[model samples]
Each structure stands twice: as structure tokens, then as C-alpha cells.
Target: MTATDGIRVVTLAGEIDHDTGDTLRHALDATGESCPRIVIDMGQVTFMDSSGINILIAAHRALSEAGGWLRLAAPARNVMRTIHIVGIDALIDCRETLSQALSD
Candidate 1:
């Protein structure tokens, strides 16, 4: 994870399933900074399941309640399809590029 202009950019690769859900939650939500704004770089993420969706939902809610927000950036084709099908792209700010997400 790296912070870019106060927006934390977390890069995750590989499949995100039940096995990795808790870890993903921690990586995304275990922030000590108040009002943490984060952009998840999903460009490298190959796949994701419902567990990943749940974790994202929880993190989005937590961040929003804390006056922050979550953005998804550059998801792979398959992952993007899943995100769209699940309606997560609507709930979360999804960008086509990491730079776009950071700027947003």
C-alpha cells in the first residue's frame, strides 16, 4: 500500500475469496488515520467472489461513516464484470485508471 497525495492506494492481486476476505478487510479498513480516503487498485486483481463483495461493502460503509470514501481503480475485465453485475460499481466510485481514482 502506498499513499498518494493523502489518498491511500492499495494494490491487490490474485483471487479474493472467502479465504482472503478477512485479510482484505484489514488491509482496506484497518486505518488509524481519521477520515481516511482510499483508492483500491484492482487492476491486478484477477478475480473476486461474494466474500470480497461483502468486505468491500463493509469497508465502504465504515469509511463513509468516518467521513471518508473508497474508490476502485482499474479492475481487470472479469472482475469489472462481476463488480457491475453486483452493482458495486454504482455504490463505489470506480475509475478506469488509478490516477483518475486518486484525483476523484
Candidate 2:
């Protein structure tokens, strides 16, 4: 993970599922004390399941309620489709590019 202009860019790869949910939950959210602005770089994420969706929703709600936000950037079609099917795209900003996500 890296930070750009006060926003965190977390680049995720491989698959996100029940097996990886705990680690991902911690990685996406390190400190609950501060409001966090983050962009998830999903260009390399190949698959995601309900566990992944739950983690994302938890992160989004935490960030939003704390005056911050979360964005999903450049997710693969499969991953993006999962997000769309679950309506997570409506709760978080989904961008087509990393540049757009950072700027937004």
C-alpha cells in the first residue's frame, strides 16, 4: 500500500475470499482512530466472494461515518461484476482508472 496526496492506494492481487478476509480487513483498515481516504487498486484482483464484499462494506461504512471515503479502482470485469451484483458500487465510488480514483 502507498499514499498519494493524503489518500491511500492499496493494491490487491490474486483472489479475495473467506480465506483472505481477515488479512484484507486489517490491511484496508489499519487504524480506526483516523478518518481514512482510500483507493483500492483492483487491477490484479481476479476473483472475489461474499467475504470480500462484506469486508469492503465494513470498510466503506467505517470510513464514511468517520468523514472519509473508499473507492474501488480498475477492478477486473469479474471482480467488478461481483461488486455490481452485490450493489457495493452504489455505496462506494468505483473508478475505471487509478488516476481517476486518486483525483476523485
Candidate 3:
């Protein structure tokens, strides 16, 4: 994870499921404390389950309480579908590219 211009970028790879949710949760928790804007790069993620969504929702809540926000950037189709299906897209901003996410 890295931050620039008040936007933190977390680039995730591989699948996000119950097994990997803890790691992702930790990363998000660490950043959510201070960063007002977080952009998660999901371009490399091949899959995402409910567990992954739960982590995102938790992080979103944390950031919101601090007057911060979370964004999802360049998520793969499968991941995007899951996000949309779960209505997370309505709660968070989903960008088409990392550059766009950072710029916004």
C-alpha cells in the first residue's frame, strides 16, 4: 500500500475469499486510520467472495466514521460483478482505472 496526494492505493492480487480476507482487512484497517481517500486496485484480482465484500464494507464504515472514503479501482469483471451484485458500488466509488481513481 502507498499514498500520494491524500489518496492511498492498495493493489491486491489473486483471489479474495475467506482465506485472504484477514490480510486484506488488516491492510485496510491500517490505512483507514489516517487516509481520507483510499483507492483499492483490483485489476489483478481473479475472484472475490462475500468475505471480501465484508472486509470492504467494514473498511468503508471505518473510513466514513472518520469522514474519509474508499474507492475501488480497476476491478476485474468477476470482482466488479460481485461488488455490483452486493450493492457496494452504490456505497463506494468504482473507477475504471487507477489513474482515474487517484485523479478523482
Candidate 4:
């Protein structure tokens, strides 16, 4: 029997903006195809703006529609607060670590 293990880990670092958003989006799209569980590791992401949040939201929606899940792992304080302030936390799951997110 073939066990269907569907988990994808995306580790992101540095700033996320219009220039990088497209690259991130493309990467997510490619990864989302095989993994039902998408975990974005943002522990090293030092900066994130509104465009970054939008990219995440868009990916979340796309994955959800595909009967999958999207989650954020270990966002920096500023990134976490931005997500909270923008209410993105209500839409996607956020955890303290990649291990925690994967365990869930």
C-alpha cells in the first residue's frame, strides 16, 4: 500500500515585497500541487509588508479551495503582529515552530 504523506515545507528569509512576492507565489503554487499540508517557515523572515500578507492570504485561499491547508511557522514579532493586525491569523493557522505546525 502506498501511504499518502502530503506535507510541504517552505522556508522563507529576508524581506517580502512586490518583487519577491511573485517568486514566493510561484514556489507555493508548485509546492501546493503535491502537498495537502503547506507549512511556511518564516522564522528567518526579518521583514514583511502588506504585499507579503496578501501573498500569504492568496496562497491560503488557493490551498483551501484545493482541499488542503496553509500554515505559518515562527513568524518574527513584527510579522506576527502585522498578521494579527490585518486579521490574517483568523484566516490561516500560525504556530510557534515548524515542528508544532507539522505535528498539528
Candidate 5:
């Protein structure tokens, strides 16, 4: 995790399924109410399933309710496809690069 440009960036790697989804959820929750804007660096995330999507949606809802937002950055092709399939790409901003997410 890193904090720069007034955003908290959480770098995730590998597959995020039921087994690993909790880790991501915990990381999101750890951001706390103080730090609402989050950029999840998914450049290294090769796969994601429903569980992963659920966690992301939950985080987004929490952040949005707090008047903040969550962004996804650089998801792998397959992961991006999954996110789109679940329609999360519409609810959250998905960027091709971390810099883009941090920029806007």
C-alpha cells in the first residue's frame, strides 16, 4: 500500500476468489473512514470471480456513502473482462494505468 497524490493505492496481485477475496476486503476496510479515495492497482491481478466483484462493489458502496470513491487500475485482460461482465466497470472508474487513476 502507498499514499501519494492524496489517494491511497492498494496494489493487488494474482487471482482474487473466495479464498483471497477476504484479504482484499480487509485491505479496503482498512482504508478506514478517514481515507476514502482508493485506487486499487490491479495490473498484476490475473483473475477475479464473483466473490472478488462482490467485495469491490461493497467497498465502492461504502466509499460512495462516505462521499468518496474507488477506482480500479490496470487490471489484466481477463480480470478486466470479468469486471465488465459483472457491470462494475460502469459503477467504478477503471483505468488502464495507475497514473491515470491517480490523476483523475
Candidate 6:
């Protein structure tokens, strides 16, 4: 886990489903208190399910309510396609890379 500025960059690889969704949630929850921004680097993520989307949405909502932000970085094609199809891309900021996300 590399960080840029104050944002935590969690680089995730492999599938994001029910099994791994909890890990994502826990990670977000753990940082919710101190971090004002979270950047999930999905450049290596090959797959994502509805549960994974739900996790992201939950994290976004939690962070937003706390005056923070949750951004998605470098999602693979499949994940990006799902995000677009589900219209979550409009709710959360999705960038091409971690650098782009950090800059934003």
C-alpha cells in the first residue's frame, strides 16, 4: 500500500466479490477516522461483481458524509465497464491512474 499526499492508495489485484468485499470495507473503515481521502487503485483488478460495487458505494457514502472522498483509480476494462453500466462512475470519481487521481 503506497500513499500519495494524505490519500491512501490501495492497489487491488484479482477478483472483487463477496469474499473479498469485506476486506475492502474493513480497509476503508480502518482509515475512515483519520484519512480524508481514499484512492483505490484497481489497475490490476481483473473482475468485479455487484457486491464489489456495493462496497465502493458504501465507502463513498461513508467518506462523503464525513467530509472525505473515495476515488477509484485505474480500473481494468471489465471493472470499468461494470461501473459504467451500473452508473456508479457518476457518483464516484474514477481516474485513469493513481497519479491522475492524486492530482484531482
lDDT values, one for every candidate: 0.91, 0.90, 0.88, 0.83, 0.89, 0.87
What order do candidates take by lDDT, descending?
1, 2, 5, 3, 6, 4
For residues 1-104, write the lDDT of model 1, one tens digit per residue.
99988888889999999998878888897467788899999998998999999999999999998889999999999999999999999899999999899884
TM-score on alpha carbons, each prediction: 0.95, 0.94, 0.92, 0.88, 0.93, 0.92
Q: In model 3, which range of ten residues has the least summed lDDT?
A: 28-37
**What local lDDT score does residue 96 receive in model 4, on the 0 to 100 scale?**
92
Q: lDDT of candidate 2?
A: 0.90
What digit string (tens of lDDT, one per residue) describes model 4 on residues 14-69? 99998799889876783426446678899999888888989898889888888888
What's model 6's overall lDDT?
A: 0.87
**Model 5 C-alpha lDDT per residue in residues 1-104, reported as the tens digit of each score:** 99887788999998899999778888898444664899999999888888989999999999988888899999998898888888999999999999999995
Candidate 1: lDDT over CA atoms? 0.91
The predicted structure with the larger lDDT, 1 or 3, is: 1
Error of 5 at 17 (Å): 0.6
- Tell me the alpha-carbon RMSD of every candidate: 1.0, 1.1, 1.6, 4.0, 1.3, 1.4
lDDT of 2 by residue, 1-104 (tens): 99999899899999999999988898887476577899999999999999999999999988888889999999999888889989999889999999999994
TM-score of 6: 0.92
How big is the positional error of residue 98 in model 3, measured in Å on the Cα after superposition?
Answer: 0.5
- By summed lDDT, which 10 consecutive residues of candidate 2 come out lowest? 27-36
TM-score of 1: 0.95
Best by TM-score: 1
